[model samples]
Target: MTARTVRGAVGATLAAALITGVAACSNPSPGGAADAGGADSAVVGIATEPESLSPLLGYGKDGNSKIFDGLLTHDAEMKLQPALARALPEVSADGRTYTYALRQGVKFSDGAPFSAKDVVFTYRTILDAKTNNASKTELDAVESVEARGEDTVVFTLKYPYAPFAERTVLPIAPEHVAGGQDVNSGDFTTRPVGTGPYLLTGWSKGEKLSFRANPGYWGGEPAVKKFTMAVIKDDDVRLTRLRSGELDAAILPPNLARAFEKDGTRTTFAARTFDYRNVTLPTQHRVTGDLAVRQALDIAVDRGAMVDKLLDGAGKPAYGPVPTGSPWFTAGTERAHDLDRARRILDDAGWKAGEDGIRVKDGVRASFPLWYTSGDKIRQDHALAFASDAKKAGIEIRTEAGTWEVIEPRMKTDAVLAGGGSPADPDFDQYQLLTSSLGGDGFNNMARYDNPTVDRALEDGRRSGDPAARKAAYDTVQRELVKNPGYVFLTHIDHLYVVNDRWEGLGTQVEPHDHGLGSGPWWNVESWKPKQK
Candidate 1:
C-alpha cells in the first residue's frame, strides 16, 4: 500500500478541525499513574491512522496492528513466539509442509470460536488471485492450506519455503464471518473482526478509532479495558497531544524522543531491522537510470550525519536493505560519503557540470523528483538533508511531497522514499522487495528492481531446509544487492514510543522493522499491568 493510501483517511479528518488543547499534565509523577485506578483504560496514540482493519488487505504496519492477531510474534531479539498459534509449526521431513496446532479455545472478538478454519481461510484468501490481497506475494510459495482437524492447520508448499513458519505473522480471519465474499470487496476492508486482544469499537472514517478489550481472549484478560487510536498525521500535533496527556503513549520522531526524555514520561527505543527509508531509483527514469548519477547520489549522502544530527543517534546507517544488526547483514560493504569520488564518477560518465550547477548529459538535466509523504516530518527532514548533500556533488535533487495515490504510479518512473522492513527473517523482508515477478504484483516493490542473481539467491534461500544454508543464501543476496546499488541504503531507524511511566510490562522487540502497533510492542497487551504503589 502507498503511504498516501494509508494516510488519506487520517489527513482528511485532521484538516477538518483543530485538535482541542488538552492539559499538558502527567498523572502525578513518574510511575504515579500506575497507582491510578483507571490504568486499565490506557490510551495510546500513533502517528498515522490505520488504512484497514483487515490483516489480509492491510499491508501497512500502522493499521494491521490494531485488529489482527498473527499466528506467531517476535520478541525483542527477533525470536519467534506464539501469539495466536500455540507454537511454531513443525516442519516435515522433506521441508515442504508445515503443521501448526491451534491454541485450545481462542475466540474472535465477536465471540466466534477461532479454529483451524480461520487460519485456512486467511491463507487461502491471500493466495487466491480474486482476493487481490496486498500480501499475495508473501504467500506465493504456498500450494495449499488445509485443516487437518478442528485444531490443526497444515500448509503444503510448492517449494521448501524456509520462512513458511515466519509467514504465520499474517493474522487469521474468521472463515464463517468472511465466507463467500470477495476478500478485496465490500465494507469488510474498513470494518473487520479478528481474534486479537482488542476489538474495534468505533471508527469515524477520518477522525479516530476506538477499541475495547476482548474479554474472550484465550491467553488472558488485558489490563487496558479500552484503547483509542486517533489518526493524528501532523508530527507537531502528535507530539503536542502526547505531551498534553491527551494520549497515554505516542509514536514520535527520533529527535523528539530525546526532548521528551527529560520529562517524567518514559521513552523507549527498540532496534529494528524491519524498516529502512531508502531512495528508490527508477532505472527507467532518464536522470536516475544513469549509473554515474545513481552512484553520485549514493556517495553524496551523509548517512552518518543524518542519523546523528536528525535522528539523535537513534538509528544506524543502512548499508543495504538488511540492517546492520540482522544475522544476515553483510558487513564491510562499500558505503561512504565521498564527494571527490562522486564528482569523479559523474564527470567520467560524460555528465558535465552546467551553468545552473546541475549536471547535463545529452541535453537532459541531471535532476529527478524525490517524493515523500507530505505530513511525515522525519521524511521531510530527510528529503531536505538529502537534497542539501546532493547539491554538493553537483547533482540536482528536486523533492516533491504528496499522498500515495499521486505517488504510487509515479514510482514506476521516478524516485521516492520507500519505507519497508520485517522483523521475522531475511526471506520475509528481501524476497518481496527485490524479485522481478514479485515487483508490480507484490507488497511495495515500486522500484521495479529486477536481478537474476538476487532472484536465484532468494529462491535458494527459500527452498533450503538447513538453517545455516538459508542464512548463507540470504547473506549472499544482501552482499550482491549492496554491490548492484539497486537502492541507496539510507538508515535503519529505531522506533521510539513515549508512554506514561505508570504501566509496566509493555513488551516490545527490537524489530528489524515496525510490526504495526498491535503486533510489535503492543502484542502482549494482555500481560501488561499498572504498577501498584
Candidate 2:
C-alpha cells in the first residue's frame, strides 16, 4: 500500500456541468423525481479524485479499484483473496521467490487477454526509472519478474521480505495497451481498461468520474450499472448533496455524519482505520529542529482532547504511526500530556521566557508557522488546538492555512498538519516516513527525520522474514521515536460515511488514509444487490 498524502478534505469548486448533473439526480424516496438513473445507478460524493486512473501511476494499489483488479484482492474481512490469480502464490522455502498461476479466460475491459506477459509488463514498467510512480520504492524487494508460458508469473526477491505477498494486491495493467504508448503521459492514464468490474465511461477532472459496469467481467457483472463519483471537496456540500437526493452516499467527518443519525432514510457507517493526522516538525527549522523543542511539543499537545472534542469520540489518540490497538504498537511508548514537563525541557535547554511569555533561545524566538490545507475543518481544528497547547509551554506556534501547492514548498522550514497510514504492513508506511534517504523526497519524509538507529531498525524489520525479529526491530523504531520525536503523532481517525439504506452487502473495511476512492461503505459495491422493495 502507498503512504499517500491525505488530501481528501477538499474545496467545492465544481464545474457547471457537474452541478447540473448532480441536481438532476433523485434518490429512492416518496415524491422524488427519480434516482440517478433509477435503482441501477448510484451517485456518490467523494472529497478527492485520483491524479491518474492508471494503476502504473499508483492508483488502486491497495485494491477495491472499481476500474482495476489486483492479482489478489481483499475480502470484506480484508483477508487476501485470489482475483486475477487462480489461488494464492506458491512461496519458495527461502521466502524470496513467489509463483502465481494466472486465472484462465480472464480478459481486460478492452477484450485483451489477461496473461503472464501482462503481469510481467506491469511490474517491469513500474520499476522502470522513466516511470514516475512515487510509491515504486514499496516494490524495491523485487529482483526480477518473469513469465513462464501464458499461465504463470514468477517474482524473485532480493531479500526475505515477509510481507511480499501483500504487495501483489497491486492492480495489473494490459501489456498490449499500455506498453505501446508513453508510460508517463499516455491516454491510458485517464481512460483505462482493466480486469475489474467497472469501466470508465468519462472523467471530468476536478468534477466527477463516471463508470458503467463491464458486462464481460470475469467475476460477473455488477448489479449497479452506473457509478458516478462526484468530486465535491467541501464536507458541508457533500452532506447537502446526500440530503437532497443528488448523491446516494458520501464520506463525511464525524461532526457532519451526526446530522444524518436521526434521518430514517440514511445509515451512517464507521470503519476502524490506521489513518493518523500528525504535525510535521521540520528538522531544518531553527526552533523545531531542536531536540528539546521537539520533545516538549510531543508531550504538550492533548491528543485525548482532540479525539474527544474534535473527532467527537470517533477516534483514538495515536502515539505513533502504529495505532495503540494494533499488536505492532509497543507498550510504554505512550506520551502523557504534561505541560510542566514540556516547559522544563525547554527551560533546561537554555530557552528563557521573554516578556510576552514566548520562549527565546540564543536570541531566536521559539516560533514557527504551522499550515493546514484550506477548507479542511478537521485539520484546521487540530492545528488550532496544537498551537494552543504549545502556548502553555511558553512556545509560540503560528497556525496558517493554504493549498498543498503553497504548503509543499514551505515544508522544509515550516510545520504541516499531514496524514498517512496503511493497514497492509508496518513497513508499508514506516519505511517511507522514517527512512533518511527518503527525506525531502516529495511527501515521503516531510520532516526530514534522520536518526541512524531508526534507519537501521526500519531496514532490519522489512528485510527479516522472522516474525519475532521483525517485531523487535519495529519496537526499537517506536521507542527511538519517543526519544527524538520527528512528528507529533495525534489522533487515529475512524472514517465515517453516510449512505442511503437501499442496498444489501454495503459495508466498510479497515481503511487507509487515502479513503473515499477505494474505501468507505462502497468498497465492495460491485457485490452489492439492490434491496427488494
Candidate 3:
C-alpha cells in the first residue's frame, strides 16, 4: 500500500475498532511470568524520525501513532478492528454511506472526551483543499462527513469504494485541540494529544521520542510504562547500539539481520511483508518505453538468484504487483528467467546489438539509467546486481543513487528501484500502480503505465463490494499485468527485526513499506511486559 494510497498506502500508516488485548500471559516463546507493563519500559532504535505527528501529516501513516487514534484500529494481523470507535461501521445498502457509533467514556491523553465530532473534524481536515498531506487523494472519494448525533458519524462517498473501510484507517485528530488551528503549521503537529494506550511525553528532535502509558486508556492500562524510540540514522550505528543493549528492538536489512540470528538478540521475521522491490521502467523513455523491451528485461533478470544471494533467502521473487499471500496471486504471474526468450523478443522487435553488446533501435541505444534512493543499501545492491545481469541480455543498465528530491522530477524518463505493498485489500495494494489516470503524476505508477485492461480492472475492483467480483477483477488485472510488464518485479523482502528477549508478547506479522517506528514488530507494544524468570 502507499501514501500515494496503502487503502493504507504502505506504512500505515487507517480505520480501526479491532482493538482487543492479547492474552496478558501468552508469552510468544517459552518464558516465565512477565511483569505487566507499568513502570516497566524499554528503548527502541529507529532509522528515521517520524515526518510529523499530525494526523494530517505523515506521522500515523506507518500504523503506529502512539498518541492519536481513530474510530477503527488494526490488530497484529492487520485486520480492521475497533480502537476508539465502538465497532466496525454499519454500511448502507446502497454502499455509498458508512455510519459509525463512537465509543463512550474514552478520553484523549489531555483528558478531552472523544466524540463523533472528532471523527468528522479529522476527515474534513484531510479533505481540506489547503492541506499539505501527500495522501489527500486517499480521502477524495468522500463527498461529505456528517455527525448525526453526539455518538454517530456518517460518511457519504462520491462512489462505491470497496476499500472505504480500509481508507477510514487514518488516526483521528483531536477536534478540541486541532479543530480550529491551522494544522499545516502548528504546535499540535509536534505536541499531539491522543486517545491510544500511550501518550507522547517528549520529542528530542532528531534524537529520540518518548512516551508513557496512558492510565485512562479504555483498553485496560497499557503494560508498557515508558516507550522511547531513539533516532539512529545509520544502520551500522543502530545495529551497534542494538548489540550494546541500547535498543530493545531494531529493524535491520536482510543482509545485516541474518547475522543477529545466533547472537541471543532475538530476531523476528514477519513472513509475507507485502513489501516488494521492483525496477520501474519509465514508459516515455525510448529504451524502456517499448513493450518488447519491458518484457525482455523481465525475462533477462535473475530474480531467484537475487533473492538467494542478495537477500540471503529472506524474500520471495515477485512477477506481478500483488505479493504471494494475497488471494489474487496467480501461478504464472511470475515466470522463471528465460534469457533466450528475452533475446528473441528484442531481436524480433528489430533491436540490433552493437559490438559492445548494447542493443540499438531506431538510432537509440537500449540503455537507461536506474535510480535508487541514496540511503537504502538494499536498493543500491539490487540496482548494481541488476545492471550486471542485464548486460548479458545486451541491455545497458546504468545504476545511479539519487535522493527523492532529484529523482521525483525525473521519474517520467528515468527508471527507479521502488518498493511498496500493503496487508490490506488487494485493490488497496496494487490499484494506483497501474491506473491510467494516475499515470502523469505517477505517484504509485512511476512507470506511467496506462493499460486499458488494467485500468478497468482497478476501477471495477474498487467500485464493487462483492468479494467474488473483486477477486475476478484483480485476477483479470494480474493476467494482463504480466503480459505488459511495467516494472521488472523483484523480491518481496521478509521484514526482519531484532529485539532483546527481556520482554514477552513480541510477535511477528506482515509489515508495510514504513518500518522501525511503526507497524513492524512494535505495533502492540502496549501489551508487552518484562519476561518473568
Candidate 4:
C-alpha cells in the first residue's frame, strides 16, 4: 500500500473529500431498465476481502487474480504478456535449460485437461519444502520441473535465471489433481482449481465471494456471468455501497472519486503499476536501526503535501522500489524535503531534542510501531498522516491496527502496509519482495533488509540472460535503493475503478500494474460485455 502510505491513509481522506458528481450515465436512456439483447451480465466490485482462494496461497491481487491462470499475463503496457504459457521461455545454449510451450486446448473449471502435467505439478508444488509455498522464495532457482511431453515443459535451472520468465506468473496446479497432495495441508487451500476466466462459485468467509463464467474456458465463455465479491472493510461502507446502487463496481476514495462523480458514476483514474504504499524500515530495529535515522526519516516526509492534499491528484512520488513506469525506473534520482536537513541529521546523530518534542538518545524514544490493515479507512488516513509527519521529525509514531493474522506476526517487530505491484516483470515485482532466505525466518523481509548491494542486485538480477544485462542489473538495484533507504519511498498509486455505465469491457489490454480485482481489472475476463440498450 504505497503512494506514501496510501496518502497517509486513503490519500488524505481523498483530499479532504473532493466530491463532484455526474460523470457519465446516459447510455441507456432510450428504454432504460435495459438488458435487451443478451450478454450484459457483468458485476465487478471490490475493496479488500479475499485473503485466499489459493492461487498458491493468495496474497491479495484482488481475489486471487480472478480464480487464477498465470503462466504469463500482464499486458496493457506493463508488458511481459503471454498467459497460460504459449511463448516466452526458450533459452538454452547453456543458460541452464528452460523450455515451456503448453497452451493447447486448456480447460479446468474442473473439466481438467490443461497439461504439461499441469506445469510439472505447479513447479513441484512451489519447490516443495513440505509445500509451505508463499512462493517459496520465489521458486528458489528450481532444479527441475520435467514433463517434456504432453505439450512440453522443462525448466532445470539452478542458475541462469534472468527472472526465470518472471516466474511465469504462477498458477498451474493439476498434475492429475494436485499431485500427491499435501500442498501445505489443504482443504485444497479453501477449494481451488484453475485455468482462469472465472470459476470459484461461492464462499462466505468474511462476507462474500462468488463467480461463474468458466464453461470450460480456453479463452471464450466469460462475458461477466455473475461475479460478486463484497467484503467491505468499510471505507465508509465502500462509499455507501457505491452510493446506494449496491455496487456495480467500487473501490472509490479519491474523496469518493469526487463523490462518485457527483453521485452519477464513471470515474476512471489509472497509474497503478503497483507500489500501492510503503514505510517498512525495520533493518534490525532499535529506534529503526539508525542509518542516520533512516536518512532522517527519508528527509522528513511531506512528498509534495502527500501528492497534493492526500492524493486527489492521484499519486506519483516514490523513488526506489522501481516504479517510474518501470523498465527499471531510476531516472535523475533526487529525494528531498529538508526540515533543516532533518534537524541537521538528528543533530549529528547525538539525537537530543527531548521534553515532549521527541528524539531522545540513549534512553531511546524516537518511537516506532506504525503497522496497518485493520478496518483500513485508507490505512486510517495513512496512520494519521504518518503520525503528523513523524511528529515534526523528532519521531514518535505509534499506531497498529491488525489482522494479516495480527500483522503477519509483527513484521519482524513492526512496520507494515507494504502493497507491491508488477504488470508481470521487474522480475515479477523484485523477486517476490526482495529475496533473502525467503519462505523462512522473517519472510518478505518485512524490513529485515539485508543488503550486499541488495544481495548482489538480487543475484545479478537473476542471472542476467541479457536484456541489456537485465537492465544494467535492475539499474543497479534502483540506485542501491536510493542510496540505501530501505523502504520509505511511498506513492506510486493510481487505481480508482468506480464503474457503473453498464460495464463495457473495462480497461482491457490490461496493465496499470494489474489493478487487483483479480490480476488487474479481472485480466480481461473473457472480454467483459454488459451494455445492451
Q: Which one wins on TM-score?
A: 2
The order by descending lDDT is 2, 3, 1, 4
The TM-score, computed over Cα atoms with residue i paired to residue i, of candidate 1 is: 0.89
lDDT of 1 at 405: 63
Better of 1 and 4 by TM-score: 1
Clashing residue pairs in candidate 2 (N, C-alpha, C atoms within 3 angstroms): none
lDDT of 1 at 46: 63
- Candidate 2 residue lDDT tens string, 488-529: 999999999988889898988888889888999889889989
Residue 331 C-alpha lDDT in model 2: 100
Number of colliding residue pairs in each model: 12, 0, 30, 28
Q: State the lDDT of candidate 4 residue by residue for 70-112, as single tens digits.
A: 6775555545666777887787986878787878888887786
Q: How far is candidate 4 from the true structure (C-alpha RMSD, Å)?
A: 17.8
Q: TM-scores across all candidates?
A: 0.89, 0.94, 0.89, 0.36
